[model samples]
Target: MTPEGKALSNIVILGFGFMLMFTAFQTCGNIEQTVIKSLNNFTASGYTSMSIIYGVFSASNLVAPSVVAVVGPQLSMFFSGLLYSAYIAMFIQPRVWSFYTASVLVGFGAAVLWTAQGNVLAINSTDTTIGRNSGIFWALLQFSLFFGNLYIYLAWQGHDHISEKDRQTVFISLTVISLIGCFLFFLIRKPDPSEPTPSETSEAPLHTESTDSASVSGPPRRSLCTQALDAFVKACKLSVTKEMMLLCLPIMYTGLELTFYSGVYGTCIGAMTRFGHNAKGLIGISGILIGVGEILGGGVFGILNNNRLGRNPVVLLGLLIHYLAFYLIFLNIAPDAPQAPEEGTDLQAYMTPNVGVALFCSFLLGLGDSCFNTQLLSIIGFLYKEDSAPAFAVFKFIQSIMAAIAFSYSNVLQLPWQLLLLVVTGFMGTLSFFMAEWGVVAKRRDSDYDSI
Candidate 1:
């Protein structure tokens, strides 16, 4: 093919690959929320089941990047899509084992997709455009999620009046979306030529004088085990750089805050349902807010990052907004005195606080999360070269692990003080702001070193 043709083809492939990744990611989010609603319909414990699924999925994310490195991104993505399809098929059965098994598969698939997609983007773009490309890629993924949720909501509309068969049909429709995504995967080509092979460019050189350093250091030590060990050590060393470490803190905080709110939202819905409230409506509303928040945040961040507004200030503002939202959520949960004569037996009184608080919190969290996420990407782009994929993948894995732990604990404790989680989340967000600010400064220092 001509050079122009090849370049065009590569871009097309990247776009398709991105779409596939988004479809997979959004599908995972959709499934998580749907599982809760599905369990409620089956009269099963929604929180316990959802928590288990999330925890397992989060843990799976930790190893997924390594798996992709071993297997190659294209195959990894293909397998992930297949796994997702299988999981959705099993969900149609509705047994506990089916749900649990499917959850594991979904988690595994999501991890694979995330890692592979990051690798693809890292390989394809230059450092200058990585931030812009990353922003657009992530925004598209969020949009996919927004639409996925809308699809599910519409599918299950009028649930109160629908029959069991109709509910089943709704789920089946949602599952089919994944199958469609799998077919789309075939259209995606391999990594772009501009990007290095994973093996060739696995490690960033210690300094700008990479050739001299390699010559002095001599040939890389032989043995797969030795190489792997060396890679891990190097990764660890790289990760601890003042800039990288600072960056990781905010990423971690972002992960924790996002996970905590997710748990709180789920728990709130559960609490309201137990009290015989309009659980379905509440969940639907929360879903809408999350979808909207992701889109709004993604868009706003994209614009701000591209403009002269520096990354640090934008992230700080996002955190402040997030903090306030958490506070509002806390107040919503504060118990109001009994009103009616049958106050003790009244479900509405018990349910009102939970639902109202959830609605307000969801909107604010959504908006703040978007802004925070965008800024985080920009910072990562600023610190590293185009090969930031593995680093980004590793950071995501860490976040997922933390999220898994929190989710598992939430399930086990069955904490009634769900709002309290928000307090911890707020504190984490504040810490993250400082960490991000430090990261920006540290990154500038590193850039100076590179320029020399």
Candidate 2:
């Protein structure tokens, strides 16, 4: 590819690759959650199994940077998708052991997938367009929720159970889609050797200081295990910085919210709604509502661009909106159970009246989520530039740990406690943005931002 063509192709490749992965990943993930619920997870309302998924996902990220370094981005992504497919296969026969095992495996793929994806996007996109591009990428990825959820709605419409034949076919289709993503990933051209990574670029904050300029000149001879451990320790030390820690807080809350959406929120939906596919199908629809919110939020942010509107204000607003959405969900939607049946009560009508409000709440959840998350990602990718790989790794590591905790407590915790998570976490997350003095530049590092 020509220089211009190759750059454009990079954009197209990421868009296409992520489209494939997101489609397969969300569909299968939703299916797995549905299948698990149907089987009756008497063990902590199935939150334990979900926690295992996030926990393993957290552990896998410890080596994700190393995997990305050794295998390169394309191969790392391919293997990541493959692992996701393996985890999806577990849905066919959901058991406690198998389900938890699959969760662990899925976490493995998630670490690699996200780590590589963030770096690829950061390298390929410019600071000027990073905000818009992040928004676009988020919109495209979330779009999968729309299609995947729609499929679930159709497949299990009006029924609380899926037939064996349908189940097999659905899973097989997801696996195939994942395979397609791998192929598309393989088509992506390598990052141009001419491009400077964040570490080489002056824009990135200092990560590791040079002790002796000429002492360490080449790649270390240590194994991947040693490299990962060294990376972990470095990340921990760096995490203590005001900017890093501040960023980590909100990012960690992002994980908490993600856990809630992935496990707790859906579980709550099942509890409140008594219709169609053990409320699994309904949760799928909720996914679509969230997609709508993300798309709209992304559109607005993409239009504004972080440099012009100032990233912090937008993020703070998003935090407020997010907290409001969850508060509404806690108050009007979550605790209200399906009303007792009257004579000849329509089974389908159970809690149907409240669904509109619930769907609205779901949209706000996505909007608020997309709003802050998009900015955080764009800012981090822009400020850290080439150092994005490890920067994001630390972000993901902290985020996943918090998410695991939230999921672990999902069933055991009371509604008030859950709301406290939203309240306090949201407050701290919003506050973290103030603590961070990020350099928001349109193209190059602005003179004013030299302080960052």
Candidate 3:
């Protein structure tokens, strides 16, 4: 095939691949949330949360570069889907060992999956299109959130307490969906490395628009050990930059928010019900609202992908949105807010007067989350384009560690302490924006446009 033909083909493959994997990833996330409610026990869910995060988020990051270099992005995603399925399968009978073991596998899988996807997408696109590409990727991925939550909303629509059969039914279907991702991953071909352009080979970190861009094809392959060590060395150097360090603060904050939304927020919703407050059932409606917010936020961000105002305005807006959501969460968390569960199993009671505002708050959280996460990807990919593998590796490593801490301590925090934690993190997230180089990709893109 012609080089241009190959490049166009690779882009289409990547765009579709992004859509498929995240569908499974986000679905599994929603299912986990629902499962926690179904089990109606915080301790098991906590162990699951802590262990899985360590496995999927923390430990895998330690070796992400080597893994991606060895296996390539398509293979990396293939295995990631498997790990996710393993975790989903454990929900059927979540013993301590089973849960923890599955979590580790999922962690490794997630690290590789994310690293590969980011590398492939960023490396293949031009500097001018990175924002748009990442935005599109995020927009596609967030759809899974919508579908997953919609499923939860439908399944738990009228259920009082979720029965064992219900849990089995929901989980079994989620596992099936996750397996489909594995199949989709098999269909993608790695981008060709023969071109002299900046895009990566299957065996190298992405350098499409990087300051330190290099071609992997010109030299003989390095040993995996040497490659891994070199990757780590570069990441360590980038890790020391003020911009990188400052930006990490927000990424870590994102980890905290993830744990809260995934674990604590569900518990809080259950608590709003009259049937023992924190009773076990799906917080489907709330989850749906959050997904809706994410979809809207991502779409808006993608549309404004061409904005010359730089990333600063969007990030600042994200900060404002998340803070507002956090404040509402703090205020309306009272026992009587949702007016308790009705006599039947209908969940409509939880949607009563006081809960509407909190649900809107959830919507805002999703929106804010999209703003920060999408921009963070664009910024990191742009700044460290040549070193994207390590940049993202470091980012994921810190995010996972902070998330692990949050999950470990989540159960012990009462409302007041949780509120305090949110406040601190939100402030840190806001500060992170100022610390980062604002509108870097935008400016670069504008210059590229001028040159053209």
Candidate 4:
């Protein structure tokens, strides 16, 4: 392939790999329906078994990054793909143990894919372009998942049609996609030599200082591990300045709100179904709105940040909108429950006030929640140049961890508790206010440093 073709191919392959892995990881979004169906075909223990399966997957994210750091990105992707394939293959058995085991493997593999993709993109793109590239990558992956879920939902149609055999088929197809991704990874050329190696780029400033004659007369040799360790230590020791803290607040708030929305959305769906509402279309519409929101938020934020509008005000405004959306969800829509039947009847009822509230809440949540991460990522790109990948990775990891916990708690808990979880999450938005303020101050410090 020509250089351009090679680059394009790399992006395509990597992007597809990311999409497949993400689909596998996020298939949990369908778990409520899947578990409900599994109970009818299998023994009563199926629900608990499914929970165990999901919980294992959630726990895996905590360790996936550490694994990726030790294993090279290519190996990480390969190993992850292999594990995903194995997991899907095992789904044919439909045993509880098989489900749990498959979930763990899929989770581990997905973490590897996630970390590797970010590293690859960072290596390939410049700072100015990285946010846009990342946004596009994220958006595409999400779009793939949206369609994947739709396909599954349409195929299954009603809960009765989702047999173990059918579930196996679904996973088998996913495995094939993963295998294709793994094969494509081999075709991906190594990072361009013109681009800095991960180690060199991550520790460029230190390496430059060590080599400079004014700083050190001789070639100051240091082990890569030592340099990496020093870089990490420096990153950690760099106390969260008032500016840094302020900058992080908006992101953190959005992160918290995101977790809440994810948790509440599922519960709201169940609630709507219980209240005799057709929520399927509403759910799909919410997904599209979220995609649109992300595109708008990331694209506009990137352009504005690149031009003149500073990151803080834009992010702050997004946060405020997010906060309002959450308030609307909690106060206006989410509190209503299905009214008790006036007369015992065999016939099913139609839409309830609760369902209407849920649909509206979902739309608003999608609008507000979509922009949080995109805006935060763009801001991070604006803040640290060399450290962007690692920093963003760490931030994403934190969000994943928190989101996993929120999901787990939502799954286990009952109604008011779930709502309470969301309410608490809304309060977390307060943190974003400080993060925005911090970013404003940090820009000044950055300017002063540049002047020096």
| Ranking of all candidate structures by their TM-score, best first | 2, 3, 1, 4
What local lDDT score does residue 25 receive in model 4, on the 0 to 100 scale?
A: 39
For residue 327, model 4's alpha carbon misses the true position, in angstroms, by 5.0
Per-residue CA lDDT of candidate 1, range 367-397, in tens?
7777777776666655554345456655666
Pick the winner on TM-score between candidates 1 and 3: 3
lDDT of 2 by residue, 1-452 (tens): 55435644765677677777777776665455445444544232345666776787788777776666545566677778887777666666555676677778878888888877776667666766677778777777777667777777677666555566777777777777767877787666544446644332531212111112134453454654565565555556555755677787788788888876655554455445433333555767777887788878877886566545577777787888887877666665434222111111133321343666766877888888887778777777766665666667777878888888887776567555676777788888877765673523333456657767
TM-score of candidate 1 against the unseen true structure: 0.75
User: Which 10 successive residues of model 3 have the least lDDT summed?
Assistant: 206-215
Residues 107-222, candidate 4: write the lDDT tens digits.
55655565555555554455555556555555555544465555555554433334666666777776676577676666556544465544336634332331232344533344
Query: Of models 1 and 3, which has the larger lDDT?
Result: 3
Q: After superposing candidate 3, which stretches have Cα over 4 Å from the reference?
A: 1-43, 192-222, 274-282, 335-353, 438-452
Candidate 2 ranges beyond 4 A from true positions: 1-5, 40-45, 194-234, 273-280, 334-353, 438-446, 449-452
Candidate 3 lDDT for residue 355 = 55
State which candidate, 3 or 4, has the greater TM-score: 3
- Candidate 2's TM-score: 0.83
